[model samples]
Target: MLVSSIGASIVQTVGGAVKIHDMSWVTGSGKTMSALLLVPDGASADDKRPAIVLAHGWWNNKQMQDSNYVELARRGYVVLSIDMYGHASSDPLQEGHEMDAATGMYDGVKEIASLPYVDTTRIGISGHSNGARAANFAIPIDDKAATPLISSVYLVDNDPIYTDETGKYVNYYGDRDVGVQADQYDEFFFRSYDANGVALTAPRDYIGTPNAQSFLHFGADPSGQAARKPYTTYTQSVDGRDAVREIDNPAQTHPWGPFSKQEVTSLLTYFDKTLGAPTAIAPGSQIWQLKEGFNALGLVGFGMFLIAFATSLLGTRAFAGLRAGPAPALVPREGRGLLWFWGSLVVSAIVSGVSYWIISANTAVGTVSFLGDPPINPQGAVWIIALWAALNGLVAIVIMTVSYRVVGRRTGVSLRDIGVLPGWRRFWQGILLGAIVVASAFLIVFVLAYFFTTDFRLWVIAIPTFTPNKLAIAGIYLPFFLLYFLANSVAINSFNRFAIRGREWGNTAVLALANGIAPIILVIAQYSHFFITGELISGFGGINSIWLFPIVVILPVAAVVTRKIYRATGNPYIGGFIMACVVTIVSVSNTLTYTR
Candidate 1:
């Protein structure tokens, strides 16, 4: 089916040439797979056009290949950006989304190469992160992927996984065109590059690493390996075909590498070299970011519309039972309390920055790629993040309590006055009404996405409509996410915004700003090093820049809506419950998950 923005493409017959289509067909696994396929205008399968299959990292979907798909397709290859099993619109299997990338890639290659329009002999495969792992699986003489259809392979942020000291695989990569792009500061990257575990400070340094030495032989001299350390190309004769091989290490992190112009252009350039471009366009000229903007805009529209729908439904008769009724049981609120405004700013930033890197650093998610399947449970990354959220929530509650109790003990403000003390009737009512109201808005949006074959997204931040498996995953993850959002809402509403001195709008403005901007500033600070100095700033590893925009979008909205919901229903429970539900559902549905 032609879904969402997959049909969106630019048909430029001149130097600009690309037409993108979104569709899914049955794979050999008999599961449906989704892809964004771009063909150069007027090119048919009969055209024997060179083709490439692009895949994204672990816990990510097809959109992560955004820049590559746009740039490569424009350069005249039929580009297929596919969602791996258990992601996006692709039908989920019982297990093995990342582990079985070979099956999926081979499925695409067999179907694509069989097409008369595509040159079966010139097909290439590309992937980043775990997708790169899958791409590695597609090559070599391994049983998982023995596809002769692959003429070349492009690896981003990864090295050949199944390899020996000489970088020898089951034995087919020596005959194919290969390119490897590694980022300087990817936490998991250097493990494959260096055997003794020393990180690379330069590109060509990879030529000296453990299994990385395998890339040196694209028909090049073994003595010249040191000179071809990273970028300087080396080629050798493998079965008489020019098995052109190249490697580039750039100044970016693992997550942000695919989106960067320098990295992505390097990616496009490699394809242009091996796959052959029809028109000679400059390597760096790109407009894929504009499409990314459209996707972001869709997310904004989706979020704002949801808030509007929920707010509107509160006024309707079907939800008449939920209209503002009574107050809730409050803890205890005294006179005008200390806002802890500056304290919050400092603490939240410290907690966020420290937790962001520490949890990841301590977990197997960091270095568990080859550790015998790594026992997939809560996903080391997910568990760490969940712990991070719960800890932050505890901090928020503690800080809010301390400030309220210590600063002012004057006049009495009951649980009712502070707005948490709603009756039992209203407490349960909030949960019931909030669920119904939030679900209604979501169902409407998801139904539209279902028929349209798309989800609300902006660039890499995606909120796809769920499959049953994803929904089930969402349910499993809900309590953990709730631990974060519920604490956040309660803190912001109950204490963070307590004792407002000015007008309601001023209070709203301050609270919203306070709630949202800290993370935005911190996120931008981490990425500033990337944009300005082209390096990952210390203490903020594994932080994907894609989170910057959406967090900025949703946090303020979370504050505003929580305020509105609290005021309408006169309690914090309902508002917190609703916000938690929406946040968890949006987050879980959009991320990558493993089948357990």
Candidate 2:
């Protein structure tokens, strides 16, 4: 019942002795599915033929497999090409309409295998690009368990194959050696394999000679393309006969379907030799063909070190402008005592030390186990500790700066005349407030995540139970948010000074608009993830989708309301304090509700 003018072509392909039919099947979840089936001429009721199922790649329609279907059909095999979910002629799944390639491939194979003309025992699967990866995922599923049942796999221009627990081939394809002219070809292959822990390798045995030319197309001059050879060079020993016989035509550039007379012949030969007329080759020989490079721990460590070094340099320069300068002489102040600054430094250092100790303990218990060995290299450990200490010292400097400004404000005003007492009360209050705000935000988010989503249970409580990495990630994010709020508050306060015409209202409106707009953009970006991948934004179970827009709108309105209150009372600090309180409450409430 796929009603469309395009259905005419499928009808045309169906005409003659080869009866083409369209049918729907159900998946594991009982979702109805559709596919195009091709049966050869003069097929009998008991006739069984080796069948090949073709899966279309990312953003592609089932018609893309037309050439492949025709070729396979011409070779006397019943061929089926399926339209994946969310693509042409397929039903949409979710809001984003994105389909998982692996799931589609598995189901497609199962549906095709149930066909009357298809020899269930000799099913072969093929896909291009994302479909190629899907075909790889489909081959090992228990046929008795689901749809798109696969027996063997044939990956065209796809790279090496791997075996699943059931020992079926997962063939991959890519450029043997990517060069300037072949840049996009490399990206296409890398995207399919890298995320799944597979690496693209050069076709070592296929390199050199007319059968495996370096140029992408035979008509294109070889000199116009990158100077490097087309195929990867391998030192591993492979049989001479195997090398020459396995080599395919060099004109194709990662094309999945049949492109020309030469390509169709090559594909038929490959399938006939590999899948039809089976051959026995050493497993190790095939494995060697899949690898292009070695994974070295030393190289990885060096790369990380370089990145960390760059980060440190950038962090230092960012805070350099905040360095203290000489105070103006007109202010009669507490004479810039070293003891006051040094005491603040000592307290900050202690707090930072405790935080580091906690983080290190968590890292040791969590990340270390997965890393094989503890990341306790002396040099790296020193750098991490030093950076944390430096950041804490910067915080202390900020506190001292605020104190200096207060001292300047109270210049020449004696304690008795000012009706104030010089004591540790103010100092301790600031310190306690900073700590409470920092700690509360972290605790609130943690509790919310624990109560609300199964994510915490799955990631933390189930697998890698008691991992410190979870704590570290949460801790960093929470404190970072707090710092961002504080910095924003300071900036807004300074900006308010320049307002003259409806100063309070103007300043408040500006701050509210800026804050609201920033978070709105971020929320939109987060939602886009569903269309691209199933992954949501980190933490809070994709709660941003529900709350971000409302909060963005509310915050600005609250800012405006607070500005009016401040103007009526002639107390700007009161306005600022109220704004801060409202924001805090909203944040906490959002976290709690989202988590639940």
Considering every candidate listed, which one attains the maximal TM-score?
1
Over 1-596, each residue of candidate 1 has an lDDT whose tens digit, in order, gives: 12223332221212335655667898876878888777787678456688899988766778678778777777777888888775566765344444454637666776677667888767888988778877877764333454468887889988654345585443347678888887765645654324675444433244465445554654333444454577766677777876777778786667776688987788878888887876567889987776566556666665565456656667777655556667443332233343356566577767765665565455454443112122233333344445566777787777766665665333354555555566677667667777876787577556755444445565556766666655565566567767777777776676555434434656667667766665677677766765565445554553433344566766777778787776665566666777777776766555544444
What lDDT does model 2 reach?
Answer: 0.39
lDDT of 2 by residue, 227-322 (tens): 335323212112322111132324333432333344444445555543452223222122110110111222222223322332232235442222
Q: Rate the local accuracy (lDDT) of all candidates.
A: 0.64, 0.39
Q: Which stretches of candidate 1 lie over 4 Å from their true place?
A: 1-26, 29-32, 39-41, 89-103, 141-147, 160-172, 190-226, 229-234, 278-282, 320-336, 339-358, 361-380, 395-410, 444-454, 498-557, 567-569
